[model samples]
Target: MNDKINLNYLESYAHSFTEKVCSEYFGTKKYMSGQEIIQLSPSTQVNLMVIKTLFEKWNEELEMLKANPYFDYKDMAVTEALKEFMNVLSRAIKIEKQHFIPLLEVALIDTVLLAIDPLVYFWGEIEKNPSPFHHLKASKKYIKWHEKLFSELISKGDHADEEAYKKTLSEIYHQHENQLSSPHILLQDLNKVLPLDWDQLIPKEEILTETAPIMQEPAQENPVFFEEEETPELPQETAAPAEPVDYRTSDQGEIDAPKPSLGNGKSIDPALAWARFEAEQGGLLKGPIESLEEGIAINQRFMFTKKLFDGNPDLMNHAFKSIDECDSFVEAVELINERYTSRLEWELDSEEVNEFLHLVYRKFDEK
Candidate 1:
């Protein structure tokens, strides 16, 4: 009658379709009651995280039953529960994991059916007895299922609510947005039975031409597919080599600006600009730098000593008095790291700290 009924209908449809498909193909027997597929109550809002967690739990249970034959596969109740559980998990896997962890081509067909519309493939009459289960389904079967569902649910005398029907279809589309391989086809099929303007719901750019009906071809000894023709290549151009521009160093023997400057007279050297920015930002580091004052002092002395001997370990002498005092780069880093850590509280050994250090080093590497 409303959104609630519409939502419930989809939930029921998914469950019923899942159970029917399982029974028809997976050697499962029909049972009176099946496990819940979509666990969300009518009032609960659907969330991706919640759905993912539910799917993970459902998958774990399904796998447990499937891996051990000790769990009776023949019991109608067990079989039905397994099918419904798999249906729920399969939907979730399709929605989230298909792109990441894909199945083999042979298995993906039934898996997609269990997710999209299991009822039509499982219950409706088709050309093949076993239906191949991998090929495109006959268009007639799709049309028949559509008409049957519409007549029974949407077009019935008192139950016929056009708005509810549209809302339900919209919800179905939204839910399966990621999972359905061809939502356009489903919309086209639905348009055949309903009087509603289905094209309006689909943007013109996405609307596909009517797919040709699957032809019933006789089996051949050696079926061949036509190879695609390759386009001719364009002629190559020979170009003069260009000189490389130095990004790190300027003619003034200072770091260059990270960004290119416009032809304004107020252009600034990048290294000096970066140092000024760091010093200005240092004011925010008072609290954190105070906490790591010892580590900073030790690191600073190490850098200062290293600079005095030109990075030569054998020339190190803490007692040498002739070395001139210049501002240490690590001091600037200590301030930057402290400021960042005050807000985010990252460890000194963390990947973020390592990356930040490398970025700072690269800024000074031009010299």
Candidate 2:
């Protein structure tokens, strides 16, 4: 099978490959007035471009992250992105509302599934349990499922051939529909399954005397684990079934690059570089943390925004809810990434980051 599939490629197709489509998709300019700073601003255009650019990058990263077995992305990219985008855009209404309203409605469905699709969350006060892998299905039973439409459109965009898209989508639909009951494919590990008493439990020194080379653990870990380590089973809310493959960073790096992308090999800002790094490394979702040491370092760096996270039980709840909806840390990072990118692009365009922060602090401290 091909290594990496760019949903961004599909994403670009879903929305026309233009800032106008993205702007119209999100209605970013809906609130602009004739005299507003956004009046004829290329910065606004660039901001929208970067936002979509990063979203696609993050989407790819989440896929890579899911290989951790300990990380999940079903909820993050599919469920959470669906939900948060809707929540963020819920207030929108415009002259073209009729046209784009369906996207918003799709967002609502995405949110509902993401929120309730939890490996197990109460729906209408009724607790239910669904396997992430099991629920990875939906298209077969529902003739009009969203995947059919998305797949149809995506294939149509690919222009493979007449009915070629349908034929391909049919296989995908069957795979997802049947993945729940599929036989487990296990390749036994020699070292892990090696009998301890092969030589009647010979001592290491004696074994070394035979000039035996040391065996090591495989780099690939099992894919598809819930973020909650103690969970008795996979979350009831699995999106799509993506197998995780463990490899060294060096090996995985080879899997990360796009077949063809827009980069021109020019020097970019360090911040953009960092944004790209996070967007890619997280792979369509969050990455598997290498060690407690690395995780702690990340947490400490994000500690600067810790205060903004305080005094809000809702926010803590929101984090968990977001994970359940988004399915992984990488998805959360994407939302944060999008917002940060938007904030930067917006601030840069308006030249108002300083002014905006000044106002925000003034009210925050009531000074």
lDDT, candidates in the order shown:
0.29, 0.27
lDDT of 1: 0.29
RMSD (Å) per prediction: 25.4, 24.1
Report the Cα lDDT for residue 236, model 1.
Answer: 28
Query: Alpha-carbon error at 337 in model 1, in Å?
Result: 16
**What TM-score against the true fold does each predicted structure earn?**
0.17, 0.19
Per-residue CA lDDT of model 2 for 78-97, tens digit only, reads 56764465334322313243
The candidate that wins on lDDT is 1
Clashes of 2: 23
| Candidate 1 segments exceeding 4 Å error | 1-59, 64-188, 192-196, 204-206, 214-367
